[model samples]
Every structure is written in structure tokens, then in C-alpha cells.
Target: VGNDTEPYKTQKYYGQSAFPSSAQTLTVLYNDHFKPEITTSFETGFEIRMFKNRLTADATVYESVTKNQIIDIPMDFSTGYSGAVLNGGKVRNRGIELTLGGKIIDGDNFKWNATTNWSRNWNKVMELPEGIDGQQIIGTGGTASIIAKVGGTTSAIYGFGFVRSPEGQIVYDNAGLPAYPEEIQYIGDASPKWKAGLTNSFSIGNFTMNVTIDGQYGGIIYSQTHHKLSEQGKLNSNNMGRETGFIIGEGVVQNADGSYSPNTKQVKTADWYTRYYRRANIESNSFDASFGKLREISLQYNLPKRWLKNTGLQSLQFSIFGRDLATVSDFPIYDPETAALNGDTILPGIEMGQMPSPATYGFNLSLTL
Candidate 1:
């Protein structure tokens, strides 16, 4: 919870002419009657060791409740204010985490230790402010947003999507273009279903090496960067049709008598891609946020005490390390671990103008007296 006033931020995008007033625009509104948001949490955990303390396990379960959540109040664009900040309502989250470790090999000159951790979390909007109709927009990028809906997860993407039939088939119109839902709806959850990590350490002859890997299993993100890139034919995915100059849309088109027919109309490639990958086409622009990465690796050599005895140093060690060295993800423009920035607020799930994932490598030395 915070009682201090928040800072105002606006990123003026001059070159983009897609949206109405893309040059410099107003995004958020200030409110006078602001209340601090508060969250209360409870947790229970345990630690256990077995087999002469060579094997260990730790587990915890937690529940949290948040009230007066500071969120955005939806406003009409005609009013000149895209959204206003206010104290929304209640939310709940529950999760559990477990970690296990064991010594795979134990010896005087050689040893191996491994550990793994896994966690799962679920959240729900318990209540909403009056007149919100059970859902409230919390963050926005382009035309899509992160929203909190009653009985839904707090991190949900709200946007327009391609209209589909009962069997999960894309619906196309007479123009051979995909149709869309007139009403905005919840498209996907931004929160990951589960996350896991693994670490291993090896020691031999006064030398030690450690490796760590981590991953997020489930989630989705709406990326405006991907949309813009695809529309501009900068992506390999949208470049194929350019050579042929045109492409036919794949779906069933509605006929005059209301029957559906296979769409064979060859729409211009440029027009097809631009409309398909536009920012407002949230569902088409969103993708799975799942990713796996080699989080870190390090190697260290510790000088033997017998050799250090003659030197002034009591202990000495040298280490080489690398972090975020590698990653495997389906995200197009940057890392899947991206979020939307609206003013001073950081909202997860939507991506726009975020930086790429970074990697670091370095060497270090330690001396003990």
C-alpha cells in the first residue's frame, strides 16, 4: 500500500499514425479521493531432512487478499481522458511452492549436489467497484489491456478478438477478411500457471561449478511490437506473401443466403497483413508467453589452504560467471518476460516498446584474512 502521490509519465510516439492522435496523447487521469491499496497474506511452510541430512525438502502454501486495489477507471475516448485512477476492489491469490535437494555423489575429492523448485499460483477478482460491471481495466497498450474481472484471475488480457464459430473456427465475411467481436472480452490470462527451476553444483579438487535453469509454463501476451513488425513485413511470417504479391485468406466466408463457403478470394498481401496484424486485433497479435532459459552458470577455484599458508591471505578464490546466457521462447520481438508500462504503473501481459532480454558475463576474486 502506498499513500504518496504517483508520478506521471507519457511516451510520445511521433512516427506512428495508426491510432487517433498517436503523436502526443493523454493516457491517464488523476483523482482527488484516492485511497491506499492494502494486501494481507498468510503462509505455512515446512522443512525436512532425511538420510543423514543428505536429502532435503521444503514446502510452503500461501494465501493473500488485497483490498482497495488502485486500478484504472474506464472512460470514453471522447471525454479526452483514456482512463482515471481509483481504488478498485478485492482480489485473492493462493499458491504453493516446493523445493527438493539431494547429494547425488559425496566423496572426499568429488561431489555433486542438485536442487529443484516448483510453484503454482491462482488468483481471482473477489469484488469490483460499483458500476464497473464486474470487470475493470488496469492497464492498456494500443487497444488491448490487462483487466481484473470478478471470478477471474487478476492478470487477464482484455481485448477484441476474431469472431469464431461454435466449433472454434474462424469466421470470415464476404470480403474474405476475418470478422471480429463487436464487444470486447477477456482473451487470455497473463499469469503463468506454473514455474520451475533447477540448479546443480559440482565440486572436484578445490574447484566448484554451478548451473541453473528456469522456466515459465503457461501464459499469454499481446505484443504491439509484433503487430507493427508483421504489418511492416519485417517478420519472416508475413514476408512470404510479398513474393506472390497476394494471398488467399483461409477460412469460411458467409454467403448471401447465410450459408458458409470456403474463402478463395485473393486479397492483396499488403492489405491482408496490415489488417490482420493491426494493434486492435488483439487475439491475432497475442502469443503464448511460455519460455525456458539457462539462467546462470559459474565456475570457481579455491586455493588450497596448505598452499595459502605461506601467503599473507588466509583464503583465496577465483570465479567466472554468466547470467541469462541463453533462452528458448516463442515471443517475436523480445523476451516473453515483458510487461506494459502505463504512466508509473507496470502491468503484466501486454508488451510495447520493452527492452530485449539482457545477458551478463564477468569474473570475480575473493580474499579472506
Candidate 2:
């Protein structure tokens, strides 16, 4: 594969850096010392067929190591700059993919075929070239943020989390709301544990039918839209605790001596949700993205030869197809496959006011000469 690298980045200047007059002056935004990134990868795949070549299987395993990772490293403004683009990290990824296909039945007038595929990936940060702390900010869009750390997975969702007692009981603050740690905490991972798909096709006489179902399991996504709309009292979740006078959060409080006691704070109805449910910057906004979808379906039929004998048309076929017809997911907003930003981005699994995936259906006609 070809090398992937970003263009060289330079510090911003308030004025032109070059001299255009007798005197020239400018302010640099940050120090610019970035190097190109490099990735080394190796992959191997094999295929097998059995049962009189009616069943076939293929598998592949691959690993990749990326070095000299160019990232925008953060810095204190006291240094006269916000951050700098520098070559400062390493990441490794490994995965396996498997596919199986079978001709379940074959005859002069009837045929059926099936295919399935599955894949899984694991990633880790091998090193940080800048020698910075274990965790560093990599990307941010609205309340959602991504952080990279040594020995941690990539694209990890970083946000505020509720404090808990030693026995895993929620801790409430004096204000009766769930207390949050001062520092941002890693709350969720954006990578799925595995993905799979199945497709089947059948044909008899002049009619054919095909359908596919796919699914992704074991990942989380943050919905900035849900957070915002809930805060605005527009989401159904916002209705909770509103009709009631108060709602008590579940958990125990930790006293000064580190003793855990049952929480007796009666958080006001509005106060309870606004602090815990709203985007008060405390609640974990991440939700499971595991979902299954009816990806595609189609039906086709070939016209009988006698139907167009005088027209000199040897063959004609008509088909009706649909895409993204249905989906089942726990995610509250749009389809789990939707992304806030397209193309290559530092952070994934973030949805900020994303549109729903539209289902499409159409018909096609083909004529053979």
C-alpha cells in the first residue's frame, strides 16, 4: 500500500512572516516541528474448498504498526501557544477476517447459494514519542472528546464519570446530584469487538430472490444531539422525574473518614435530571452501539420468451431492490452506522446532530440484444 502522511504544518502568524515593507513583525501560534508518519503492515490470507467444491472458506490475518505518528500535542498557553503538530506516537492494529460460501443446492431448474463473513480487530498505543503523560487529548467536537494513551486503545471516548464508593456505590455530592471526578475520565471505547454479515440467494424457473443481514456488536457511541435535546426538554428521557417531586439517586456516600453510608439526599425532580441526565458535563453520554440491520433485499424475474417474440427481444428482466430497509439498535438517535464527521478523523463513535439513514427502494429493467 502507498504511504499515508499529512502535509507539513507551520505556526500561524498574525502578520505576514515574510518581509514586504521596511519593517515586518508577526506572532507565532506555536512551534512547528512535525515529521511524516510511517506504517509497516503484513497480511496473509488462505482459502479452502471442500464437499465436491460446493463449500468454500477464506481467512485472513494482518498486523500493522504505525510510527512517527503526527498528532497535535497540547501545551499550556503560558508558553505563548495552544499546541503543536509533532511526530509523537505509535499505534498497533491487528485483526482477522473470515468468509464462507456454499452452494447449498444446484439443479437444472433450482439453485441456492449462501455467504457469510466476520471480522474482529484489536488496537493499542505502543508508545508516545513526546514522552508526555500517559493520556493526551487527541480530538474534540462539542462535548465528545478522544484521548490516546500508552497501553490503551485508540479513539477512546473521554468524558466525565460519576464518582463511586469502594463497593461500587454511587456517591452523591452535597447538592444531592451525582458527583463527578475533577479530571476527565475514559468512559467508553469506540471500536467494535466484531462484525458479521450473511447473504443468501435463491433461483427457480425465471424468478430469483436475494437478501442480506449484517450486524456489529460490542462498542459504544456518544450522542451529542441526545445530550443537547434532552437538556432542552425535547427528548422523552427528559420527562423522567419531572412529574414527581423528587428522585433519589441510587448509591452510598463516602464520609470524611472513608466510611460509606446510605445516601439520603432527596434530589429535586428538575435538579435530579438536569444534573444527572442533562449535559451538566457529569453523566456518561456513551451508549451501546451494538445493532443488527436488514442491509439489502431484492427480487427479479425474467420475462418469458413468448412474451416478446414479435418484438425481437431475446431476453428481459425486471428487478425491485431496497437498501438499509430496517435496523434494530439500542442507540437512541440515528443509525449506529452514522458518523458525525466523514473521512479520516481522530475520533470516531461520536454523533452530533446527525441525520437518520434513509431507506431507498427502486426498480430496474434490463433488455438483452
Candidate 3:
């Protein structure tokens, strides 16, 4: 369990002293408030051994919940303030982990061993006080966007879906395409269902080797950067550019004679630009919600014991590893592991030439007295 508190105070006033016969202070205000939160978590697991202790395994599952989450909600400055912090919502998470180790073969001259670990997590929004529903809980890292709701899971992205008519029917354009408005729709979320990992090691006749792999599956990532770049004509490779038609279609606000009409037409590229990009900051598009294998593969080897012994060294080893080694998507950009879902940072999963995570190849030595 955990708890937190914040305090704030405010004062607002208008003043005029001596300003070249002009007025100065329109509005002066100082404000502050206090907010507190608490969190609790629990986990349970087990360990077991078999085959005369040659094989060992362990598994664990955990659940965590937090309440009174404080956030700096943006304010309408027209009301005379920039923003304020409030205790608004709650979140919950649950996961399971499994690890195994086994001596495939053991003997004085040769031995073989293997080890693996796997895990899966589920997150949801447990509650939201009044006036705040269907919000998105974006992360601080890459471009991941999670959704928020009462009883909804964590790392979910919640926003407006395509607009529907008053009768709850999808509006279609003359082109027969579903007209998506430049405005966002609270249609779906971007959260993974699970993640997993594995590792193995072996030794035989004075030589040893090890390998490791890890991955995450069943999640979604929103690439705001890609959206912006694509709109600016930067990401020519992004085929989504061909999608200039609006889901809400188009409509004339006023007739040439100053009258309005319900006959809206298909939105054009100009409308798409003004509505989706210029105004909304280009974050509404570029969402990849697919299951994928994040990364896998690693290898290492130890120097022969006899060679190390003769060199007066206790041990010596070398290794090489690669990340984002493979992907199952047709995404033309780089790896999709660039996004995160938590706070209002930028979008994640948009792979710019930002420094790619390094894959290391090196060696090490250890000596014991």
C-alpha cells in the first residue's frame, strides 16, 4: 500500500497604480490545492523441484490497485487560471510469472542445463470520479497511449470513435467510404494482453554456452510522431497518406447566400489537413494495435576451464546479443517497441532515426583468490 498528499492555495485580484494614464493589472491570482492517494498490492506464487532436484521451477501471480490518482488537469484559462491538480481516478493491474531451471544432463565430465521465464500482465481502470470518463492515460515513454475508465483495464487508450448519426448509424460518403471526422472517436484501446521471456544454458567437456529471449504480445501503440511527420509530407513511405477522405464526410457550414444546408459532401485533402493536422496537433492518427513478438535471441560462451586454469584466471566468457531481431508486421518503419502508455508525454512507437537501442558484443573475465 502507498499514500500521497499535495497542498495548494490561491488569491485573485485586480490593481491599477500609475501606468501612463493606462490600466495594468487585469487579473492577478495565486491558487493551490491538496490531493492525496493510496495504493495496495498482493502477490502469491510457489516453487517446486523434481527429478532429484535436477529440475526446479517457480510461478507467481500478483494484483495491484491504486486510488485517488492525482493529475494536473488542464484548465480553461478564460476562467482565469492555467491549470489545477485533482485526485480523479483509480487503476488496477494483475500478472503472472513462471520460471524454470533444469539440469538436462549431469555428469563429472559433462553437464547440460536450461532455464526459462515467462510473464503476462493485465491492467484496467477500476474507477473514475464524476465528470471524468473515457479519458486516455498516455505514457511518458515513446508513443504508447492507454485508455482510462471505471472498471476498464490499465494501459488502455480511450478516445472518440467515428461519428455516428443521431440514430446511431454510421454516415457514409458518396464514395461509399465510412466518413471519419477529423475529430477523434472513443472507439478502442491500445493495450497488450500479455508478455513472455525465456533463457537456456548448457555445459559439456569444459565448454559452456547460454541463450536468452523475450517478447510482448497483444498490445497497441499510437505513433503521434509518425502522424505529424506524415501530414507534413515527411513520411512519404507511410501509405496512410492516401487516406484523405474524412469519416464524418464534409458539409457546408453556410450557403453562398448565408444559409446552412444538411447536404455535406466528401471531405477533401484540404479539409483533412485543416481538421486532423493543423488543429488537433496530428496525434489522432497512427495507431498500431496488433499482437507481435518484440525481440528474441542471445548467445554466450565460456572459455575452456583448462585454458583459464593455465592462464591463472578463474573464468573468462564472451557474449553477443541483438534486439528487435525480428518482427511479424508489415509496418514499413522501424521496430514498433518505441511506445509507452502512462502519462501525457509524446506518442510512442513512432520510429524516427532516434538512437536505436544498442546490441552489445563483448567479453569478460573473473579471477578468484
For residues 45-69, what per-residue lDDT tens digits would candidate 3 score against the true structure? 9999998999999999999888877
Which ranges in model 2 have alpha carbons more than 4 Å from their true place?
1-35, 78-80, 232-240, 280-283, 304-315, 342-346, 367-369
What C-alpha lDDT, on a 0 to 100 scale, does residue 311 get in candidate 2? 92
Put down candidate 2 lDDT per residue, 179-285, tens digits, no spaces.
Answer: 87777777788889999999999999999999999999988888877776765567776676677778777887778888988888887776676677556352456
**lDDT score, residue 216, model 3?**
60
Overall lDDT per candidate, in order of appearance: 0.83, 0.79, 0.55
Better of 2 and 3 by lDDT: 2
Poorest lDDT segment (10 consecutive residues) of candidate 3: 274-283
For candidate 1, lDDT tens digit of each residue in 56-95? 9999999999887766676888877787777768888899
Q: Once model 2 is optimally superposed onto the true structure by TM-score, how far is the C-alpha of residue 132 displaced, in angstroms? A: 3.6
lDDT, residue 293, candidate 2: 97
